[model samples]
Target chain A: MMDILSEMLGYAFLVRALVVGALVSACAALLGVSLVLKRYSMIGDGLSHVGFGSLALATALHAAPLAVAIPVVIAAAFLLLRLSQSSKIKGDAAIALISTGSLAVGVVIISRTSGMNTDVCNYLFGSILAMNRIDVYLSVALAVTVLFLFILFYNKLFAITFDETFAKATGVKTGVYNMVVAFLTAITIVVGMRMMGAMLISSLIVFPALTSMRVFRKFKSVTVCSVFVSLACFFVGVVISYVYATPTGASIVIINIFAFLLFWLVRVLMTKRVAVKKPGLVLLMPLLLLAACGKSETAALPEGSAAQAAFVLEYPSQRGEAPAQAWLRQADTQGEADAATPVIEIKEKMFITQINDIYLNAGDYIGKTIKLEGIFRLEQYEGRQYRYVLRYGPGCCGNDGNAGFEVSWQPRTPAGAAPSQKAYPKQDDWVRALGTLQTYEEDGYPYVYLVLSSLSVLDTRGAEFVTQ
Target chain B: MEKDRPKDPQGIPSEPLILCKNLSLGYDGHIVLRDFDLRICAGDYCCVIGENGCGKTTLVRGLLGLISPIRGTIAFGAKIRRTEIGYLSQQEAAKQDFPAGVYEIVLSGGIGAMGLRPFYSRGEKQKAEAALMRLGMAGFRNRCFRELSGGQKRRVLIARALCAAKKLLVLDEPSAGLDPLAREEVYRLLKDVNRETGMTIVMISHDIAAVEKYATVVVTLGKEINAVGVGGEKK
Candidate 1:
């Protein structure tokens, strides 16, 4: 298990996901407390739906998903707040009205346009690997802003949450603070949507709060526990997704659900005992265990960087032997007599040696459809951009050679131009790409590349540096 | 116009702390209490007794400036601001479901005085501590609010109210769920605070017997608000 984990940690994309995921999770938990107490938990659910609709619109228009979705979702959040406040619409009805309506419009646009493409899937489910630079910078900035605003208004939020009437009578601007909560919630939803996905983002807000409430009876304790629980859940969930190849959003939510049940059972057991004065000690025992998983991940993360850097540097510099193809290819074909499928689905065990073979024997592999799953990389060398689906393999310099091929998207029509990189998966996404193998001559150097027919991110992760 | 006001029987202070003239209060456009006139003087222990739906809480809300009067004006005395007026409302659901400690709840009463400040100052913390001590709830400072019994929760909430009671305090159904022993303790505490601090108090209660026992001034709410002082003429 440690071997697989150490290998997975070498990738830069996973690290970025954990950092941003932790921040977003903490913010959601803090706001979730007040929202749950105020009976506004569904507002998160509503806003996430609004987020999905905006992401769909962004995809259709070929705009940056984060940029377009943030403003639209924020406007929708305020609108939902207003609608919920009014007497006619009440609470859940208002949310249901707007959420279903926006979802419908998004569905129509998607069906009429690209029709459930990879970008759309990334928003629907979460894809940490799908986050680009803008997504990362904006998420961190807004998460910090949300955290600062929360700290600035902590007492006011607590006061209003516990008793709004009293807070108002005591001169707290309850309405304005309510708006602040809504505004913070909107930011959290939009940023968290990238990691948790629109369908499951609100779970990030709801689960941790409800879980903490089960054991910690005080607001401060509940709040503190909620943060830890959220962070722990995200950490464990990401690891689980990495090892088991489950959807990241779904994995996090499952861990949250599991934590809530554990806390609930502990509460019930302690209540039966009647002698346990401090349940915090007993409850936090399991919480600490979950956090320890995160600790182990962080400790294990730095070990494989040296091996990965060597592999990356070695792969692009080495030359593939041109004459080893003729006899090796006929023998390789005879050995795999039943491998007549249109596409060769590369398995994890065969990932390294197979890609190495393709690089050395580019002519024999041309016109063959190969399905490969690895990290989608955009490398810049000599002022030129090259895209590849790659994983590390053992080379002369430890695990220093990248085992993958450069891939280019095929044009949709004969006369039409190929879509932009934004239309494909983002940088360092764990993608499953199917393409026809081909060779391109660049600067008098024969290079193996693939003309991609389809590309989409996978929640599954294999060994980052393979020896096979 | 000032000379026309009735004199107090105990001669504490003749100046009214909160004077509401022809006040109409309710939610939305509908009026629950209309054309009600009342005056509470400094150092007076005023007890308001009325049936359910008589707008006793509404009147309390109006006095605290939580709701605007539909037809008339409410005038506060020169020294009193709404921020100094401690308010314990009848909102129970949020309090029951809220996960807070007794001390945290009490400390939040200083929220009104924490203008532009993110947290309570040292003086405010001391004030909250003093309020808890005054109500004899210092022992329950670390107790979770939801873990407390009905009477204990009421006492803690009253202690919270005292933290913000600089000059005047208003409570709605503070002793509603208490047993006779707890009820008497609450009443005696209020009587002691009223006598010692000279802070004006307006409490809404269904306990007419307790009201007559401790109140320096009693107001009966029907269609109109009628006030009579202890051994004094109706005001």
Candidate 2:
């Protein structure tokens, strides 16, 4: 271990990772106790998904990913918190909804502009090796902020976490404390997301508290143990990940699980000796066993049917839009089929497979007029209307992938007279669209779409869903 | 029951610590208990008894200001701020495996008194320590809370509440899961605390025998609210 540590610390990136890892680990562990006890353990998961979406957006825009992702994820955390507080939405359900939706948004952004860049994978699976000096600095600063705030409100957090109702009665603003926890968790997730990946960042927040709880029963002891365990596991996991060439996020998560198992074994041994003293532990062990089995449920909730049916970018999902080329066509009998202009006609059999290629290699198709036969979808999202000409493709897991290219619909001749909602075909209408392939940017992320010269409803609808 | 207490000359109460007039309480737009007019005064050992789902717990919540009244007004006395009222909810109110020491839990009672100061004052610490000693929980100060017996946990919670409260302590089902001996011990502790501190207590309990034996006032609620007392005032 000494040899490995000396050699590993020689690399600047590894050193950066170690510093940030130790700091973030301690921060996550401190906040994790409150989150786990409050039954908001999955807030970490939810905030990470929101982080993924913002990172994708930042990358596509060529903006600083962390600079853009931090605020966005914080807002998302607040949103998830408020949603969970509502009587209509259950906490887990609220977490599931926001996390999956953000995941879908991320996928749509990746599918449109950058087709699964390795940077995206690092965010998904963690890459401590990729840390830069700036990331280390940011992580250090943010981690310090989190730790400072947590310490400053330690007693209040304890009061609320132990019993929110009681704490509220005593004059501690439960809402403010809860928001503080949420805000701190958001910062921790964003800073940690770079190294741990969105898929595995939640483990850093959950594993330590849980492991400490297995053997230690006092809150202060459990918290101190959690922070210590998190730091120790993080370093060990980093070393193992480097030595074994495994994903850093997975390695850390596995180490945490191992620690939890070891502590659980010790607890069981202690239980046998102290049999009559701890009935709650012995009686609740089965229930805890069920929970342990359920812990493997990492985020990756099924995409909603709306997202599944129309996985289209340029749909803006909600970052407002820029006014682009507009031509609402009844029918363009004369297509833009000049000798210089290339026209690619999509084959009916290969339509599902070909759209994927077009989206993936957008540089090749830009400025070319493409004619395709597919469904016309008019979507109303967050008070903004978007039009798409698309078809369904094979989904990973369930409804993970879909092919929908946004068709920019603006009539240039009608000067400021945007196409009325009635002018477009109804949602899910089968139509043949001929338009020039194009890309537009919003929030720095480029989105591929079609500028239609001709869009008319078709009498015959092609295959709606396809495996090809 | 204590026989040497002085009864108020008037049958009707005045200058109540907590006054509820036509108060309607519910959650998520569903009214569980409504039209509750109650007045809890100082130095009253009042026990609220009712069937399950009759809003016994809801009344406690309303009194604690955890949930606002849907229709009516719930007022506190001139000297009492909402934060000064210490509340001990039902057993399940706190997580069973909460990783806290007996002293840490008791010390947390000072959280309400700490408005903006992050750390507890020396005086507050002394108060917590005194409350712990008074409750005979000084020996369990360093012990883990989850390892304590149900009755012991109750005593620790009461001690913590004492640290927060200057005049009022609200308890919900303090004797819920205790054995007969433990139950008697809890009642005796409460009686002693009430007699010694002269602090007003509003406790929700199902033990009619204990209520008759210990409580100075009996406030029954189910179909209606009736408050009658020996040394305490009637409502």
Kept native contacts, as fractions per model, are 0.73, 0.88
RMSD of 1: 11.0
Candidate 2 has what TM-score?
Answer: 0.69
Model 1 pairs in collision: A219-B99, A310-A400, A311-A400, A311-A401
User: Which candidate gets the maximum TM-score versus the true structure?
Assistant: 1
**Whole-model lDDT values for every prediction:** 0.78, 0.77
lDDT digits (tens) for residues B102-205 of candidate 1: 89899999888787689889998998899888777889999889878877787878888888788888999788788888888889888888777777889998
TM-scores for all candidates?
0.76, 0.69
Report the Cα lDDT for residue A370, model 1: 86
Residue A141 alpha-carbon offset, candidate 1, angstroms: 1.2
Per-residue lDDT of A165-224 in model 2, one digit per residue for the tens?
778987788998889999999999999997899999999999999988988777877787
